[model samples]
Target chain A: MIIMVAIDPSYLITQVLNGLVWGLVLALIAMGLALIYGLLDIVNFAHGAFYAFGAYVAWQTLLSGGNYWVALLTVPLAMILLGLFVESTLLRRLYGQDTKFTLIFNFGLMLVIVQTCRFIWGARGKPISIPSELAFSVNLGILSYPAYRLFVIALTSAIAIAVFVFLRKTHVGMATRAGIQNREMVQVLGVNIGRIYTLIYTIGICIAGIAGLVASPLFGVYPEMGAEVLIPAFVVVVVGGMGSFHGSILAGILVGQVATLPIIWEPRIAQVMIYIFMAIVLLARPAGLFGELGR
Target chain B: MLEVRDIHTFYGDSHILFGVSLEIKEQEVVALLGRNGVGKTTTLRSIMGLTPPKKGTVLMNGEDITHEPIHRRAKIGIGYVPEDRGIFPGLTVHENLTIAADGVGAPGGNYEDAFKFFPELGKYLPSRAGRLSGGEQQMLAVARALVGTKHVLILDEPTQGLAPKVVDRITHAIKGISKKTSILMVEQNTDLALRLADRVYIMRDGNIVFSGVPQQVRDNEEVQSYLVIS
Candidate 1:
């Protein structure tokens, strides 16, 4: 068939689709990390674990004969409780402590979670077939794309919009933002800053968990899957600028294309693209693209 | 009424406040006069539970609140307008007041009366507090305290950096407020402290060396000399 003969057009389209799909999910994951860092001023090293946990739990729900939509509701709730436990028990102790302790402590938690996941899910990557009702291809003018990719974009964008509005419009949102800017000032205003911190942390992890559940349809469930994207997530966050939501989205898109474009033409060097872009951006603008001045 | 008894406050073992003690009767404007670094602001912070003075009993209307959190102190009718104004820079004047007022319950009894004092606040309710002039910011800070039943109002250096006219305006505003709520004001300007103070305490080295009525403050030549030198 001529389709096999004409690989170039199909290949480029596939790469673009791959980048956009992964980028959307990656942004969701990074947004969670950034929100926690933005408010608490703490690097949540266990965020990748939260993403992995989300995927595993979503997979568990599916294997147990649960509706796919149930994953959306359950994964976030599970991660929220987990986040509350972790923050109240361990993260709370490191509030005024050095960031080095947080990094070390969370990295330890990450190892434990990863090994535990390996113990339960085993070493092999688990296959989670996309729901049959939703399995279809689209003819977008000259190129065909997966319907699942569009769902990934739409669903994640919806989540992001809900989160953005929640943080910007509501009373709790205003209090949380205020607490981020001045926790002591918030306390003076009769707000419970400790409670707000826990709430922000939980919401952040829930976003990551939701990201995992959303991406499970695309990437499948696996233990090492999180490690694969962890570095890139940090790179995207740094590129997007710390604490600025708009910057994170833009950076995620840019980094996504840089990786995919290279992979389309040359598959092996695709992995290096994100790190290269990150280093160049770091050297040029240490604060990231839209990072706050002096940060 | 407010009382501070034997409050020992330390900032990393430097001992900023050394068992300092003071009291203010209801509806009285008590001025705390001291040279810089003599723990005046620290005393205000201790009373506000901002610093949580090490060994002290801060009582508001006979209620023991030495262990009360800062927010609890705020809710329990202690309105603190810090020396810096603490104008929520990103918040508008309206948003600023709303944050202080929008708790789950009704205003703690005297909200309507408090709004009448700062009639100017109603004019610029939509404006950002950070953009307001020094005097206006000071007014907003005071009004914020007033809007939520100020049983004990603490103003730190309300006249510290203001121009002479703004200072006079502030003096009048504070005077107007003194009729409704008890005030514990910390000021370096002796004349402002003296003229406005119902009772004055001259602080030296974190201890009350000279405390008396206005005539006593005016008559103490040594304190007068130190104020000029300070």
Candidate 2:
């Protein structure tokens, strides 16, 4: 008797696509965290809270009969305003004093925001409907995929390109990038370092907001959902290295694959795979994959 | 156009400058000369508001600005080129030149002027500052200061470690720049100080030991006493 074991190509393709999409989202979060840490020297533990807030904002917009495109614009704007207010009133005071104060303050902020979200949204997770036009799947020669997932990939790719161009081509972006290496040098040249700090923080928060708003439909909007992504995103940041942009992107993809691919064979060990990878990488290269020592 | 009067700067409990006073006229080049760690750089730092003096005043063009921030001091026409040159090692030469030209009223918008001052920097405009040679870095530091609106340019040890030819190149550029903008330089090389400065002050143990023209300082026997290795 001959026994045949079948391998499903569609399953593999779906897993790979899922990994890529999730990796891009994680990259967005990690990049924002890294940018804030690099320029303002703040670890921004409240970053995930900002992401959750963005999702809530999107939910509110959608509830008011706004389309996905409208929520897309409104979420980032709302987050930017909140970021500016928080930065000027609270975070600004902690700067130049102690990093520990900032870290604790951000942790407090995360708690406060998560609690506020819980009080408003209640214990039940809210389901967000995908846009009517994007509800269908597109046939790609081998497998059919959701149009919205492709849209997410395209949108993130565009944002990544824009960010790369901004950092490489513009004067302000170049100064910001240079400031990460040496702040005093930028200051002596007469650039007000404080103003740059505000801009960097706001931009970082806005990016987090974007990630949250987009992911709300896929992952039901819930209060503690931020923590679910936050833990793994921190892992991505550690694997990418502090203050390293390209490092975070590569590490995010690696992590997404490690987190998702194992589920096909054995679902139990999927979560543990990322930590094992991180530990091995840290042991081999303490500075992270592309991170510089003593940053 | 600058006056630093009775400045007493301190670094924590250890006092660095004791009643140090100096003056720089419009378009004049004043050099502060001393051996290592005699508070020459401290005086510059105090004036630039990096390590502000506890008891003293710094006046630029008649406005007292002792408590001003470092960037504010730069905005008010005080361009400080520090000892280490303060180059943004990751940025290109062109980016370094343009990063701080946000305000108006200083003579920093002329690319031809910067290129005319140091032609060697032209080739390195696209290269990162960390790759440049010592002389080129010094030229870039001075060039960055001049690119913005700055009336009083403060330089600390511009030729500390360089080939004699590079020193000549930097000194020649300073002389050219000094004709247009007032300069306050700190130099360990007494000959270079005397050659470029209209007036010279010798610092010793956190105080101005002697102040006179280069010839008077060269002739004074007391100057030798201050120069002795501690």
Candidate 3:
């Protein structure tokens, strides 16, 4: 019994690392949702479509005999340009309207995007091999960790840092924050709020794209790739609270812990654990842990 | 050097400003006076093209600007500071000021003149607009409106919630502008507005009820009790 329980925590610790990696993936997707829904008050349901692009682009790069690192860099830039295109053309049209329109319409757009992906890539999962260099696990005294997973952790942490810094220290970030408070007031102050809105949308979607690209090597790419990451991202966004960056991070990790660590006990119900926490969090705080009260 | 002629504007389906019109020349300060919900703000919005006037023309120096966009109007020396004290709360005081001037057509920007009016803004240049006190934000709103190049400055309300002492400072600042620019201000404080205005127009229910020199409109207690307050 002691041996079974002893392997339990080690198994759990390993799962904890898995959960961190998973949470980072969700956090990237959440960054986009947080920017558009949290800050702009526009629920960009089409975000998963962007995530789909990140996975497929990375998939194409791998199939084309290209380096994974080049694919990593190129995919995000492609997503940024894609974000810019969607913003300047379609998203700009929907802004300031009742948000019910965005929710329903973007869902429709999401359907179109998914169908497009299905048409192109077919309805099958494709496994991606880790770059040969990252296949080894690093053994710390207490735990043995996969180096590729560690790379994922490091990359996600770095992206999270960069995101926090951008939102806290940059001009566009400040404008997004103010625009979130009162859009009309910001516009009247002589700032081109239209331009600011576009930038936020681009940045938000690109983050999701990066999340997709990074996850491709680990989970591989599939037509339903968005479905795998999106549910957790929504939960992360909610558990993280609307527009609260740090809240998203903490909540993401916590949700991740509940999902992966608990899976060691009952594999069938591992994913269900996240919903349980989200339900509890909603009942108790509604804003999730670290969520602001008055927002 | 501003002329608003027979402008019509709407809010949804409601016709707010029907043929609203006003004129103010260079170095002159005009007051747009009215009671609540009578479309005073709409008239100003019409001029700035915020609510795109349905029919009418706005001329700055005899040029038709009936369909020109707000920024285009801004480019042609028309600066607007809305009634709401629209401060971009996410920006630092400096960022707020910078965006107003960067890539904007501010000819001979009297940056020094702006500093003279509200030097308090210079101190909190790095602070976000949300962090500043209300009065400082007001100063920032005004400073942004005037920092760039414009010959005509239209302010909806510069002293709405400010203390009397702050109002005095704002009024004094308005009085100090040189002859190169014109000022059009709207205020609820009839006494304070008349004191600063060279010309005043009392608007009632979408039309000009009274228009004259400030002295002529002063102590017109009958107009005050009925139009100004009621």
Candidate 3 residue-wise lDDT at A89: 80
Model 1 regions more than 4 Å off: A1-17, A93-101, A262-295, B103-117, B123-130, B133-135, B225-230
Sequence-dependent TM-score of model 2: 0.91
DockQ of 1: 0.39
- Model 3 achieves a DockQ score of 0.27
Q: Pairs clashing in candidate 1?
A: none
Candidate 1 residue lDDT tens string, A132-188: 766898888777888877888788888888888987766677666666555666667
RMSD (CA, angstroms), candidate 1: 4.1
lDDT tens digits by residue: candidate 2, B141-209: 998887655688999999989899999899989999998899999988888888899999899889998
For each candidate, the alpha-carbon lDDT, in order, equals 0.79, 0.85, 0.78
Provide a comma-separated list of chain B TM-scores, one per candidate: 0.93, 0.94, 0.93
What are the per-residue Cα lDDT tens digits for candidate 3 across A4-32? 57675666678888989988788778877
Q: What is the TM-score of each candidate against the true structure?
A: 0.88, 0.91, 0.88
Q: What DockQ would you assign to candidate 2? A: 0.55
| Tens-place lDDT digits, model 3, residues B4-57 | 998888888888887888998989999998888888888888887778788888
Tell me the deviation in Å of residue A276 in model 3.
4.5
DockQ for each model: 0.39, 0.55, 0.27
Best by DockQ: 2
